[model samples]
Target: MRPFAYERAATAEDALRRHAAGDGAVAYLGGGTNLVDLMRLGVAMPARLVDVARLPYDRIEHRADGGLVIGAAVRNSDLAADLGVRADHPLLSQALLSGASGQIRNQATVGGNLLQRTRCPYFQDISKACNKRDPGSGCPAIEGDHENLAILDHSPECVATHPSDMAVALAALDARVRVRQPDGEDVVPLERLYRSPGDDPSRDTTLAPGDLITGVEVPAPLRMPARYRKVRERASFAFALVSVAAALDVSGGSVRDCRIALGGVAPRPWRAHRAEDALRGRPATPGSFRAAAEAELAAADPLPGNAYKVPLAVNLVAAVLTDLAGEAS
Candidate 1:
């Protein structure tokens, strides 16, 4: 790793000030799981490191509205094991548990997990051309080793997919992200945080350079059956080839409401709005689930080698919705 100045920040303001004092390439250190890997691989070359893990953003609090306010510094394992989270937002807890191994979960923070970069091989290799790493350098993943890349909402400049399981759940649950900015604080829906790689693959999120995520706010419990299912090459410590986070509220013999989000298929956690629209008020059956899944997959623009992901995602979505519907019934 390159030699860089390091400082421990006692507060969010301190961290922001320290980052502003450093050269433009300063990075906030939290858990140091993904950032350290990037530094070691020479994919990231920050001039200074501001340790924000010590900041007072580690608490998980209950909101008066029967929701949750999860601090950004809270560790992944803690969030997954929290009794309140497990009891209310079980899908969120399940998504966290389905991610990295025990050791990684213990060190990964909620904010860091949401802001982590893509796991694309090309982007990780400094020698290769990756638009996300070095803009205008071109993307080699478009024609090489793209079987695991995106199949929806992808651009020619980038085909990488976001690798956060927690973000996928947040998108499905309609969570909001709280950020601390230099001017003031702002809260935005989690689904709007990520941007498509349209013309600027270098940017993964809409957050400004100096902005810091403070916490995530989850609305009141759905009080419905929900599930997070992932399909990968192996059962443990593997990235998802296709994953689905779904919540269903059924009334009588029909679907009253539902939310669905897909991962491992886009540059961001794809909120299946089209599928949700199709499923709501529809009969809770395999046929209905398949139709909704098809409606969402129809917009997919699969690449040459990743056409398989289209069918995989469709099947996974259908299966997950069917299972959740059965549980609700």
Candidate 2:
């Protein structure tokens, strides 16, 4: 790993002030699960690191208004175990549990997971041409083994999947990321936080240079019967091939409201808005789930090797819907 300067920020403002001093070459150090690994691999060579681990983990706080406030520094393990989060936002907890090993989870932070980089093989190796890794460089994955890459929101310049299970659930829950900037702080809708890789793959997140995620506010009491269904090559410590985060509000065996998000198939945690629209007011049955899944995958643009992901995404969404319906019973 390249030698880099490090500092511990006592407050959010201090972190920003120190970070701006280094300009874009500085990176906020969260749990150091992904970032540290990248630094060792020479994929990320940030000249300086601002330690945000000591700041504060506001935690998953249940509000009287039936919302959830999750602090940025909260550990993944802690977020998964929060009683209110576990009960109200089951999908979020489930997604967290479906991620990396316990050791990694114990250190990974909420904000860091949301901001994790893509897992594209080529992008990780500095030797290969990856637009996401370096601008003006080509993307080799387009002609390579893109089976595990992306099937949604992919551009010719880049086709890498955003590998965060927590992000998928957050997208489904319509959670907002609270970010603090030089002027002030504001909440950005989770869906808007990520951008599709269209020519400029280097810009992964929507957060400006100096912006730091403070915490995430989820307007919860999550329309009940939510689950995160993940499909992978193995049962443990592996990324999903096609994962689905689904929440359903069922009344008398019928869907009153629904929200669905897909991961491992896109550049970001994708909100299947059309599918949710189709499922609302419809019976929470396999037929309706199938139809909704169909509606969502219709616009999916799959590459040559990733066409299988289209069907896998559809099936996983339907299965999760079935699971949610069963739980409602």
Which number leads on lDDT? 1
lDDT of 2 at 108: 95
Error of 2 at 250 (Å): 2.6
Model 1 scores a TM of 0.99
Worst 10 residues of 2 by lDDT: 57-66
* Model 2, residue pairs in steric clash: none
TM-score for each model: 0.99, 0.97
Task: Give me the runs in candidate 2 sitting further than 4 Å from their true place.
Answer: none
lDDT of 2 by residue, 1-329 (tens): 88999999999999999999996799999999999999998999999999998887656678987788899999999999888887777888999999999999999999899999988999899889999988888999999978888887889999999999999999988899999999999899999999988989998889899799989989847767788889998988999899998888889888998889999988999999999999999988999999999999999888889899888988888988898888887
- Stretches of model 1 off by over 4 angstroms after superposition: none
**Candidate 2: residue 234 Cα off by (Å):** 0.5
Per-candidate local distance difference test: 0.94, 0.90
